[model samples]
Target chain A: MNSSSISNYINTLFPQFEPALREKLIEQVTIKDFKAGEHLMQTGQYFRSTVLIVEGRVKLYREGTDGNEFFMYYLQPGEACALSMICAAKQESSKIMGKAIEDSTILMVPITLMDDLMKQYPSWYYFVMETYRSRFEELLLVIDSIAFNGLDQRLSFYLQKQQEQLQTNELQLTHQEIASDLNSSREVISRLLKKMEQKGEIKLYRNFIELKK
Target chain B: MNSSSISNYINTLFPQFEPALREKLIEQVTIKDFKAGEHLMQTGQYFRSTVLIVEGRVKLYREGTDGNEFFMYYLQPGEACALSMICAAKQESSKIMGKAIEDSTILMVPITLMDDLMKQYPSWYYFVMETYRSRFEELLLVIDSIAFNGLDQRLSFYLQKQQEQLQTNELQLTHQEIASDLNSSREVISRLLKKMEQKGEIKLYRNFIELKK
Candidate 1:
């Protein structure tokens, strides 16, 4: 996208950004693309920049010593992944692997620029405050689901949420991905999906599932 | 604590506050105390100010339908809360409740004071940024634990963390409190605690668990 388009998008999301500051930010940002399955970052790497997704998707996951995996969530266009990690784990240790779910483009803002902008702009502080607040709220939801909600309810809620957010009855998901998200096994997720299909709640396709009305 | 003491604490935590800005903040803050189990703020209450804990502790949690409770950690002295909820959730829709854990005193800085401070002392932006970053980080750890760890592991981890952070081998926690935190039944938690005690990993008192190293 052109600088003008980026500026407009940024302005729409944060109306506090002044025209001059927007211009400076647009100048500082470098948009880069990645194909599916490309790992953009991994555990132990220093996080030196904040990323705003311009297109496509990324998933953050951590692997355990027992060879098990837990999927945090997916980052969509316009969302951020690094900000939360950096804030929580510090710049050097906030390492969850960021892998491409598709051909993705991201607007990268270097930490140096961010530090400068935070100093120079009051609006930037407000923006950061809001972003962190939303991240906090999202994490609370995830925690609630894991603590009280069972796997069946969690999976159902996930599918319902996905159907609503993606605006589609069909989902581009695999059993293993769903398993990783719910902290269960692929076989368990497959069995659950089959059960749901038999109950007419959804239909299992080759690589996807379609929710039934 | 007097204004100088409060300012000194603020300065120690936030470098940007320095001496002069810290003095300014001390002028704007007022200290007040709450008795144990007193509601500092309820779910539907609008957050008109942010608080800096000067002494004692505060519990942050949410009560769901059917009277089920979920504990979202406590705010220790020198910590702050509610900036994210104030910015993100609609005034009446946020699902959180804050209460004084004991007879506690806090320095309250009204939102208007903060607004003025941000304008007059842009350097103090770092103070808000630091608090916001820590809140965001804590939320991520909660999310990570929920997504990857089981109920037993979560309880173990929570006890271990509290032991470390509080710098005490004996944790003043009730079975009901532990159940609320784990989002499980009190009976279950009581049984588990008894089992852990029998296994010689811990010692249980009337309202506490002493981790035996």
Candidate 2:
């Protein structure tokens, strides 16, 4: 909202960044907000700046030709967008989509100052590297799931991830939504979920899933 | 190899690097050779250095619990191993496997110098970023294929990629290998190839396939 609040956001959420780097971010960043269910990023869009989430949640996914979305991962208040950095550094168009699942806010750092920041601040430099490293690992995990695991195992993993990210056992998602996120048919997802329920792994409701602890 | 040969390798393969950085690489990088099929990287192994392919081809893949190798992509001359950099930066263990598909040589740059190089050489910094970007995009494409496409389409993409990378219409591969790479059954791959052949797209022999123009 204001300079002081922006400073508070940086200092509180990204205290690992050096004081001067945080000051630079406070000075240069343009804060943008997105309402729930709004697109934060879209495929074929060129990124002008890298984004750091300051509030709420964002889900990143790959879109299919048929408009199906294969869910990737989420960005929380303290995380930076990996695709944003990758596309921004190369000035290339995004191959994926990001949506704000909740009312969200992000601070955008211009690409022009990337080299300067990497050189000027050691903390900022490692922060960028660490961001790439974490996101890279996340992508690798996603690949492992899709490549090695069966659909039932993948659904289990999907539920586990949702539980971990939302920090709740009750996942507010429909069967159709799960089917869409996994790029599977609703009938198939329903069959697998019913099997999970039979196995005592979960309880399914109309629009939510309760995972057994 | 001799220092002069190493200098030649750097000068010839990576002329984009500044002279000073090239000199530094020649001084610090260890030249290691791998016989065909030798492991360059293993799942759960720690990485001490970032690898750059100087000669021959390396196949990077995800290994499943049953030791199934889902082909990721190939790393050729002038390319750095993105997983190597990601794991080295965090001193984390690798999650994937890399093998020399052909007899190969690589320049191993110690992880300790990564920070110094990033801060000192703009070219080196951008090179590292580009390596990660390319690998990330490759992984995304793999995800897209698996999540969105059916087996037949996936097989076609697999063959197309193989043709492009091997730079030959005649692919020196077996049905078993194709099935293994795509994480499908040998019979299924054979059936798909037969269909492609019936369509006059290719001619399959004992160990290789010849793509028709």
Candidate 3:
């Protein structure tokens, strides 16, 4: 285990911070690294601190009654892990899991510290409110997609979003992962991919697929 | 129109002092009344204010690409109309129409004034935050229902929710409206209703259906 400059990186997200305040926040945050497949928090755990991804990727998922995992979304660099969970701490039963997709380091700050920061720093309060608002809007858009769009359309939308977010035309993703996000079976996804390929919508490659214009 | 004691009534939803601050909010709000089947806001116009239902009921709905209107949910007394619109004001297009379900009176609070309240009052800030959270969570549950739950189960859940929210066994709903909410066709909903009737799950009445426990 090694100490990292994660706090310095976190200050970059709060670019409006004065030098003195930035130093204080950096001193306050604690950074931790986890290996891939490690669960940061699971159902029934008390998460008193909110975590920000300093490096690497994390995925948040919910397990259904039959043990099927539903993809809520992924936490990328600069994104907070479960902002909603931190704000509304009343959820006794955790419906989602934050799993590291890669070797990841995150900066954590206590909620009480956050409260003090909001009061003492009005600009910081605006930043926190904006962060929550963005996530809230994203969740609503996801709900709209689920309500209005079909399975294939959702799969297409997800792929498009991932490609844009990752800045790559091709992704090294498995059918099972796609199925998890789409809330369908791997076999169904395989068939759909085949159909999509046949229609010249996408080109399937080894461990990746390229979208067609 | 004669001025109604709407502010006195809205105070019931909040604590005493908080409602006094909200009464100041009333001056900034316009009291608008509508009959059943009247539109408060439509798809093309910019929605500038969040309406509070002081009396009667309202429904929030959007149209599909096929020009079919999908009723999302009903807003009861003391609830906000199209609250997501308030949170995400960046939307260039209106997705839903707030229609009065019956003879309804609504207090329209402009977005700027609501933002002011959110800044001045921590209690109102928490209230708005919780309101958005509830709406977002409700939508997530809806997504879960659409993806995993069977059609019959979904229909049962919808009926149960309406019963609880509306506080009535009988719902004055049309088949087309039910189909839109369930994301199915009228024919499918009709068939399911017949099947439920045979199984004693629900009793169909004139202009309404009763969910049998």
**Model 1 agreement with the true structure over B8-111: per-residue lDDT tens digits:** 66766556565677777777877778999897776656665677776778877766555566676778776777552344322324567778878887777767
Question: Candidate 2 chain A — worst ten consecutive residues by lDDT sum?
Answer: A1-10
Arrange candidates, best lDDT first. 2, 1, 3
Lowest lDDT sum, 10 consecutive residues, model 2 chain B, at: B1-10
DockQ (model 1, Cα)? 0.43
TM-score of the first chain of model 1: 0.83
Please rank every candidate by DockQ, starting with the best.
2, 1, 3
- Which residue pairs in candidate 3 collide? none
Query: What are the models' TM-scores?
Result: 0.86, 0.98, 0.87
After TM-score superposition, what is the CA distance of residue B4 in candidate 3 from its true location, in Å? 6.0
Question: Which prediction has more favorable lDDT, 2 or 3?
Answer: 2
DockQ of each: 0.43, 0.86, 0.41
lDDT string for model 2 (B20-137, tens) is: 9999999999888999999999999999999999999999989888888999899999999998998898899998899999999999999999999999998999899999899999
A93-117: candidate 3 lDDT, tens digit per residue: 4556688888988877766676566
lDDT of 2 by residue, A189-213 (tens): 9999999999999999988999998
Q: Give fnat for candidate 3.
A: 0.36
Q: What is the C-alpha lDDT of each candidate?
A: 0.71, 0.92, 0.70
Over A1-213, each residue of candidate 1 has an lDDT whose tens digit, in order, gives: 577777766666445677777778788877778999898776666676777776777876655545555566677876766453343324545545678888987777777776667557766656655566666666666766766677887888788867865789999999988887667888989988888899999999988999998
Best candidate per TM-score, number?
A: 2
In model 3, what lDDT does residue B127 have? Answer: 62
Where is the poorest 10-residue window by lDDT in model 1 chain A? Answer: A82-91
Interface RMSD of each: 3.1, 0.9, 3.1
